[model samples]
Target: MIEELAHDPQSGAPLSSVKNYPGPEVGEGLADVQTQAYRTGVRTPEQHPLVEWSGTREGTLTNGELVSAQRGLLGYFRRTHRNVRDDPDPSMDSTAALALKRLKAEAPRALDSFVWYALAERLAAKGYWAAWMLDHVIARCPHPTQRVDGEVVGRCGSRLKFRPGVGKLEGVCAKCPHEHGAVDEALVEYIGDIYRASFDEEMEARLL
Candidate 1:
């Protein structure tokens, strides 16, 4: 799977896609996590590369800050990916297998693996996991239509919905409002924030 994603079709040269380039949202969340770490007396680096990379300055980050961030990121990643427990899709299983294999092959050290997992957390937070799986793991695109609680919905036009009758175990969807479009975007962002923050904590631990 990694080999397939590494090649450029036209040039046939090895290709790489950047992951977890810090952005405004990540910067803000990191700052929050840093603050929490400071309050808890967690040690951090004098200058966190991620903070600098994000172009947000809230003083130097400490190891404590990274630890806090890692906790949050891992929690978020687990929750978002946990949907597979309810959905039980083979595609997700394949994606997980490929991701693990790539992680093991590429990351020689525990710290290196943490970095890769952190990047993956960011990608998943950005709601790009599905597209990534399609590009790297699955050769074909996802079906345009999805079945939610026995109702068929256009993948692009559907909004995940939770109601009384439709058990939480069974995901439900409905036509998205024109104004709302898709609520999952907000959910994804929320989940992403948690994932990124937790990743920092995990990285800090491995560094220690």
Candidate 2:
């Protein structure tokens, strides 16, 4: 999504909409699945740029960091996307065929076709994977975020890409320093609504 202003939830709070320049390096090597097998929680380059930010340094992300971020994003999807366990599609009507196809198209990572099965019946339902669906629909978010340092507080005048539920660990301008950011619920709901329309309109899945 293009960078958009965040809104306040109580008073039209804005969601932070980050649109990072595509990572500077092309990803090489495979996403680290072995590490994901045991590790927990989301890990991303935005959280660990693997650098010392004195607020004066300017350089592109190292290739390793790019891989780390991609792995983390895929990991985030794996952890969150709905599965057959969640649905127990005993009858396997499998509108599954089409949705899985869409997911393969949507996922940034490319792996074996069986890979999506790990997430199970993705796209079967909305909000079941709200964050994943959100990755696509969160355009022009109106959530509110700010920057504060000591007694100095300033309205954030710049935009950074937002990673759904991942906190502003990496995308907030490194120069700004305030916290307490919140996702705009109304905006999240609005995005879900439109996406749901498209999903229902074109997507027809088996009961699986």
Q: Which candidate ranks first by lDDT, i.e. highest?
A: 1
Local accuracy of candidate 2 as per-residue lDDT tens digits, 112-174: 112233223244443243333343222222233433564212233233345445553333322
TM-score of 2: 0.23
Query: Which 10-residue window of candidate 2 scores lowest in summed lDDT?
Result: 5-14
Give a tens-digit lDDT track for model 1, residues 104-198: 34332222113333345545544445433222221111123456788433223232454444343322345534444334344344334434444
What C-alpha lDDT, on a 0 to 100 scale, does residue 55 get in candidate 1?
Answer: 20
Please identify model 1 stretches exceeding 4 Å from their true place: 1-38, 41-78, 83-90, 108-129, 132-208
- As a whole number from 0 to 100, the lDDT of residue 192 in candidate 1 is 45
C-alpha lDDT of candidate 2 relative to the true structure = 0.31
